[model samples]
Target: MITYSTVKSTLIEKGTRILKVLQFGAKTADECAPFGDDSNPIANMTAIYAETSTVDEQVIIGYINTKQLAAPGEKRLYSLKNDKSISFYVWLRNNGILELGGDDHNLVRFEPLNQGIAAANGEINTELQKIQTAIIGLGGAYTAGHISTDIDAAKINEIKCL
Candidate 1:
């Protein structure tokens, strides 16, 4: 029989990682034609360009629970960030938290925080009663979003878990 305090401790112990974009959409060109092919008109078409970006890891904080689990209820809380704005939903499982929405019963009860804020107060108590069982750390993973390239304009300042 696991308790809320126990689950909360596990999530805090595991902590979270933030992903930052080191380089956004950098481009590079590759030459497909060989020296001998340079004289051919087709050689002009051999140049190809591709765009890519680099990312780094940072730290974030958040919370978790089993109110949304389908069977043996489980829950988790995570705080991670990337170069983009993201939205997260609860994931409940018999074992551990994982991608949002599967056999587990998803609760659309939670809402996003206001601008520049990562968490809000008093929201957990309202949903805590809905949980049924202790979550085992087997299949849990946080469901996150990539706010699109255009919106990822600045570096992440902070991530607070409540």
Candidate 2:
């Protein structure tokens, strides 16, 4: 009994807006450096890149951890965890990919080491059928008999009332 919207805009969620308001920080309680200190915030060379963020995620151009000398290349120096139980997104570690929020709480990033980029998004490609619907609305992919060179006398006549 689930209902879905047919409108193009409604089908697509406004991820960019969420990405804009999203705050990046360490998973630690203090929300600071890997060593649990608020002195150093920007440890990894992580930064936003390529148009601020993609429609699906926020594109950053820096490693997760490659700044701190303690645990070089250990993990993302900084990350956002849904400790507040916010059902917006989740932090993915083993895969180095944070995906849309779900019913799972395993790990969060609270270190400072490397340099990389992060792509944050909510429900990527949630509706695959939407693409097909768009294609159909556009008059389908192609047809052989109905479509022909306008230079053809019969084809031209078919298009006109003549």
Candidate 3:
């Protein structure tokens, strides 16, 4: 059996050029890595890897399963700011969640339709109105009354950096 690490090692040689962006057969992909079939070693394998040598930033994204892929399950990227300390995993048998340990915090699951989050958003609108009023109070002279209220991107003619 070709181990996942072994496959990656074979494809990417040490002291070779680092990949800038890579995306697997996509359900989703990021701006850094666009989705494509990059001549997968295995007939139906799907995987991607991207790296920026300047800041040593790297991202790994994948989607492989029984029908679409031969090796392992898909993986979302997890990258840190440090170089020579990055790690990648490709051995998830079934669909699962990826967890990270940081600041002694516990795992958090999110629901897009959660009611609590919805309720909080209601209050956010009223608070935003107050912020708009405050910015207008600054007495800046412009055709637009206030930046917060006049948020039409096309109407924005001039911008000044302070």
TM-score of each: 0.13, 0.15, 0.19
- Count clashing residue pairs per candidate: 14, 14, 0
Write model 2 residue lDDT over 61-112, tens digit each, in one string.
Answer: 2223433322332333233332312223333446444433443553322221
Question: What 10-residue stretch in candidate 1 is worst by lDDT?
Answer: 1-10
lDDT string for model 3 (1-162, tens) is: 111211131234353322322233222212122445332233223345444454434444433432322236554333322232324322333555333422245432233224445556656766666666666688743232222222233232353221
How well does candidate 3 match the true structure in TM-score terms?
0.19
Judged by lDDT relative to the true structure, which candidate is superior, 1 or 3?
Answer: 3
Candidate 1 or 2, higher TM-score? 2
Order the numbered candidates by lDDT, best leading. Answer: 3, 2, 1
Q: Per-residue lDDT of 1-162 in model 1, one digit per residue for the tens? A: 111111101121223211121122322222223334321111111112222242321121111221232454655323223321223444555565454434356322112323223222234332342231212234444333223122243434453232
Give the Å error, residue 28, model 2: 26
lDDT of each: 0.28, 0.28, 0.36
Candidate 3 residue pairs in clash (backbone atoms < 3 Å) = none
**Poorly placed runs, candidate 2 (over 4 Å):** 1-17, 21-46, 52-58, 61-69, 76-162
